[model samples]
Target: MPKVRVHNMTISLDGFSAGENQRIDAPFGDGVGWGDELHAWFVEASRDAAAGKTGTDVDYYVRGDENIGATIMGRNMFGPQRGPWQDESWKGWWGENPPYHHDVFVLTHHPRPKLEMDGGTTFHFTDDTPERVLERAFEAADGKDVRIGGGAAVVQQYLRAGLIDELHLVIAPLLIGRGERLLDNVAEGVEGYRVAEMVSSSSVTHVMLVRR
Candidate 1:
């Protein structure tokens, strides 16, 4: 059985995933966001690219995972800015190409045409509910896992629905104080998960959790 996994997500000591007023210039928030802890993780994740390698952590995480067939992300995670779709010119923040090579489903209130970028990445916007989007993504994945590449809200939906199988988080050592918190106002009686493993690198502390 393929697992629905969430990985490489960063959180503040206070549980804020990202700071408020996030923009193209300041995606993660202003100031020493997450401090040195997050900088190290970012450096390592992009180390291969920094070393001039063709692959990145994104590739390594998805590659060879026979159970991984598709990805689901929020509209915000797909690009910058918020609110209704003003135009279609905003291709994405990633240069001419993006890292996602597989089929990706995006959750959005507004509908937009699918975007096909270089390197085999395609974004499909869905007006359907989260469960419907998950179903579609899983079907497209062909029995493989579906990664929830989130911008907090999307992850929260899945978490609330108990549709997630694994939770992988990287705890950064900084505090946003304000901004969107990952589990803010979480509904009560939510399922409890057990920490399965943990790894601390010079950059970040990676924690893995499995539904208990």
Candidate 2:
């Protein structure tokens, strides 16, 4: 059975997944600015992966992209542009080639046409619930796993619905005073899940949770 997993999601010490006032200029919000500090480790790992380097932490971070046939993310994760597709020219934050080389199902209130980009990445906008989207993603996956590539709110919805089978969170050292927290309003959400592994590097702590 294919698992629904959330991998390499970086969060602040204060539990905020993203800083406040997210806009086109600042994607990760006003304070964080695309999560430079929070996502620095994974960025470095990705660079190392691109450079053909392999280590325990780097492999762990980079391996999330493997065997992931489809991904589900919120509109915020896709870009800062909100409301009814102001301009069709805005493809995404990533230029021609996005990191995701598979199908990406974006949760949005407004409908948009399917966008096909370079590197085999295609974005599909939907207004369906998490379960419905997961069903679609699973069908698209074709036996590969479904990844929840989130911007916090989408992950929270899946977490609350008990849909996630594995979660790998990278806790950064810094703190965002105010923003959207990942674990907010979902008390005991990990009741059946337990910490399967915990590894710490200089900048971040990786915690992997698996359902029992």
Candidate 3:
């Protein structure tokens, strides 16, 4: 079965996934200079991986993209834009060719025409519920797993609905002190999930949780 998974979601010691005041210039938002620092592990690991380095961070970073045939993300993850579409020119922060080369479903309240970008990526924006989006994602996945590319609230919705089968998080050593918290709520089904694995590197700790 194709599972719904969240991968390489990095949070701070204060449980912030992203900082406040997110903008095009400041990608991860702003919080005591640690906004960009939160993802340093993954970034460094990615560079290292490119240079033929394999470690806990690099392994987790690589694992995030493995078997991911489709993705569902919130508008925040797509960009810092808010409240309807005044500008349709924002293609995303990933430049012409996005990293996700599969069907990408973006959850949004406003309706917009499906964006077909380079590198085989097509963005479908919708106001549908998590379950509804997941259904379409599964269909687009073509037997591969679906990944929730989140910005906290989106992840919480799926978790509250018990839609995600597995979640892999990278807890960085930095502290944001404020911003988005990945596991803020969704307490109803907390007992249904368990920490299946944990590995620690010098820069961060990789934690994997799976629904029972």
The number of the candidate with the highest lDDT is 2
TM-score top scorer:
2
- Which stretch of 10 consecutive residues in model 3 shows the poorest summed lDDT? 27-36
What overall lDDT goes with each candidate model? 0.74, 0.88, 0.87
Every model: Cα RMSD to truth: 3.6, 1.3, 1.6
| TM-score of each prediction | 0.84, 0.95, 0.95
Q: Which pairs of residues collide in model 2?
A: none
Clashes of 2: 0
Ranking by TM-score: 2, 3, 1
| Per-residue lDDT of model 1, residues 1-212, tens digit only | 87788877778777878777777777666643433454455555565554656533434333323356788998888777677888788877666677777788988888788888898888898889999998898888887789998878888888888888888877777666887888765574145677887767544566777889
Better structure of 1 and 2 per TM-score: 2
lDDT winner between candidates 1 and 2: 2
Which stretches of model 2 miss by more than 4 angstroms?
none
Model 2, 131-175: lDDT tens digits are 999999999999999999998999888888889999998889998
Clashes per model (N, Cα, C within 3 A): 3, 0, 0
lDDT of 3: 0.87
| Candidate 3 deviant stretches above 4 angstroms | 32-35
